[model samples]
Target: MNSTLTVSWRSVQLLRILVSGIFLVAGLNHLIEIEKTVSRIEAAQFKGFAAIFGNLELLVILSGIAMLIAGFSFMIGFKTRWAAIVLLAILIPISITIQVGQITTLGPLFKNIAIAGGLLFFILNDIKTIKKQKL
Candidate 1:
């Protein structure tokens, strides 16, 4: 490979690390501040379906755990496409439910959209890599 390609690859790796680190810390924060997270979920009025399987708190905790798993998988480049998909799935609902229609939350809503876009790009790139490997 060309030196320029090598540099580009390293830069991409660093970008991946930076993106994945955000998720890791967010996941850890959810776990560490479970009560606060659950309170936020409740404050957001996430009750209906979330209450079906016991309480909204449990669902929030489960989502946090999923976030942690997906974050780690993405960071280590293990099943990266699947990890990206998982993160996208998690982000979409949270974005809609928690980050929408508030002046204070507009930033978070846009941030979630950007993250979802990145995850989608990651998924497409992984598919292209797989095709190349098979060729």
Candidate 2:
């Protein structure tokens, strides 16, 4: 008697699209509001981390490009695990550098953590399909 609840593939696709939404919007924000993103990074409590890369603008541009690419890949469900890995790679440090310090930012911090958990769901499971595989 199999009893585990099963999700429809359409629902899984919706999850993928929803999970990628933040990254897609954020990537556009980074490109469209480059100055805004930079100034926020500049004012971060651990701002000195920028010194490690030297050119803050260049770093922001690269990250924005990466986010756009990874987010697209994630939404389309192509190479989903790799997309999750790429997103997680960029997300963890950005979360620590900006969102970890301020009480006002706590909501966003937990949001990033939740995003990581979503990505991890892909990372830990072979999610190509919703149906069970034959042994």
Candidate 3:
């Protein structure tokens, strides 16, 4: 491939690493700081959302596991689209529960939105690539 294409490809990989790193750290935080995470969730705008799962602590743990697995998968470019979808699924509710409604959380809310956009990149890019491959 040409230099520009090679650079572009490397940049894409770098972006994937950076994006997945957020989740990897967050997943570790969720597990390492379970009580803190739970406390924050409890303090969030959407208390009822956590209650829906019936066990807040368990939900946190499961979410952590999901994030860790999906994040690593995304970082390695394994099932990239599926990993992004999984991360996106986890992100939406968490973002809504924690960052929505509170004016103080505007930055975090937008940050999550930007992260969602990144994940969407993988999802859409893979779709296009897969279509091309099938031709």
Instruction: Kindly list the per-residue Cα lDDT of model 3 for residues 28-76, writing each as its tens digit.
Output: 9999999999999999879778778678899899999999999999998
Q: What global local distance difference test value does model 2 have? A: 0.85
Which parts of model 3 have CA positions greater than 4 angstroms off? 1-7, 127-135
TM-score of each: 0.77, 0.86, 0.85
lDDT of candidate 2 at residue 21, scale 0 to 100: 95
How would you encode candidate 2's per-residue C-alpha lDDT over 5-77 as one tens digit per residue?
Answer: 5666776677889999999999888888889998998999866766476677877888899899999999999
Rank by lDDT (best first): 3, 2, 1
Question: Residue 89, candidate 1: how far off, in angstroms?
Answer: 0.8
- Candidate 1 steric clashes: 0
Model 2: CA > 4 A from native? 1-5, 132-135
Q: Decide which is better by TM-score, 1 or 2.
A: 2
Better of 1 and 3 by TM-score: 3
